[model samples]
Target: MIGDEVQVAFTKYDGSPHWHIGTRLLGEDEHGTWLHSPAGTFTWRPGLAFTYDRANVLCVPRGQHWAATLYDGGGASAVTTYVDITTPAVWSAGRVTMSDLDLDVVQRVGEEPFVDDEDEFELHRVRYAYPPELQAQARAASAAVLAAVTARQAPFDGATAARWLALAEPAWTPVAPPARPAG
Candidate 1:
């Protein structure tokens, strides 16, 4: 995983339709890996979605107990950044895959810490027919990520991400604008 460019993706527990295509790989350490995504990504749900560009991901490669920091480049989206607390990820030399827990801790430059996606979570609760125990776990995961992000916890503190960003600069590739989905 470290020192290799890997395909990074996030999916629902059952590998349903929802996903997050990543910024590509730069490198990693004990804390986690840094994904340099110059091109913003499209986040979708059934139909509606938005793209967030100029972002990077600092991800812990743990499955079912993983977390990530999404540092936005602040292009068009109002969200400056977010922390996705999730199930641990499957990180390998070939790819990185994480499961979404339906909760996000979002941050803006001058705004209070915000929790986004409870509605989405509830929607998925019925849609995915999530078990009670699993739903509870997802909620707990959300709380953990929020606490870490709000407290500026290690690795989540931005220092590791910053260092990785500086390292990734020389290796960055300019991606063409992503193709828009057909109407």
Candidate 2:
């Protein structure tokens, strides 16, 4: 139906990011589209007087005040295009610098040492950044592990949820246990 809600993954085309604005179609006159951030719902008309339609869509950060037309492809199938009001976007890496923080001088079990510069605090650094899909997959695995641990009545609870979650991802696994010498 025109009012159905769906999760559309944001796509980057030519560098700019866009969101599909929509609202639930109420009647023959009503149409739905989504917002870039998707804060809530909005409605439009069928006469093209407004900028929404069953076939219409809005481009993110580019297309200005113009209507959208969603070309239906027979039962939940359609190709959508919109007027380009803004220039194509360019992808640039965010300025993230890692400063190595030397935690070697720590003398306590739970004490965090200080670094001279704010940007120099890099006690932890990621090996590599994972894609969105991979991050989601990791989260799913972690959730499954927590569920299993809970089911087994492990001596843990919400207080230790973070620790348990961290354990979900195995950093390393031993191939075999060390053999014990016979007496």
Candidate 3:
């Protein structure tokens, strides 16, 4: 439902926790389900946590193996967009979870978009014992996302994200970083 809070979680291929963040459901379109993580949203992993200094929109395309995060521009960080090649998202009880494939497509301001984290992907492939089919699927998803983002394709293009961002701004509530959980 639009305006509802949702938890987004990512796990490694070996099922280790990766990133987990809280976001607001920003409605869906032909592209996919859109989520808004406004500035100050808390994102954390096993040993790291931080608050976002800029707003971003997350798109998890239906039946797609990739998810994209579109950032607000003009920040010190050059990253304008980041796409994670992952297993298709599974939603349950107001949460969405997916397995991060360790491959990413990044678009930086004033630079050509490129696939990042090949080394990490290769390392995890061995460590996690990814099956041949899974490896091939991850590679294919990376390639497809790279092309779409590079070509400014719909949902990859800032326009679609911008519209969603605007809708979220009015209802945005500030989020503080959560206290680190005790070991």
On lDDT, the candidate that comes out on top is 3
Candidate 3 lDDT, tens digit per residue, 140-171?
Answer: 99999899998999988889988988888565
Query: Model 3: residues >4 Å from true position, as ranges?
Result: 174-181
Model 2 per-residue lDDT tens digits across residues 105-169: 11112232211222221211133233455334333433443343334321112222222222222
**Candidate 3 overall lDDT versus native:** 0.87
- Per-residue lDDT tens digits for candidate 1, residues 1-183, read 333445555667677545545455676577665666554454454455556556666565545455665564456656545666566778665566776767888877666666798998789778877788878877887777677667877666767676766665555553332233456
Alpha-carbon TM-score of each model against the true structure: 0.75, 0.17, 0.94
> Which structure is stronger by lDDT: 2 or 3?
3
Candidate 1 vs candidate 3: the lDDT winner is 3
Residue 132 of model 1, lDDT score:
89
Q: Order of candidates by TM-score, top first?
A: 3, 1, 2
lDDT of 1: 0.63
How does model 2 score by TM-score?
0.17
Task: Write out the backbone clash pairs for model 3.
Answer: none
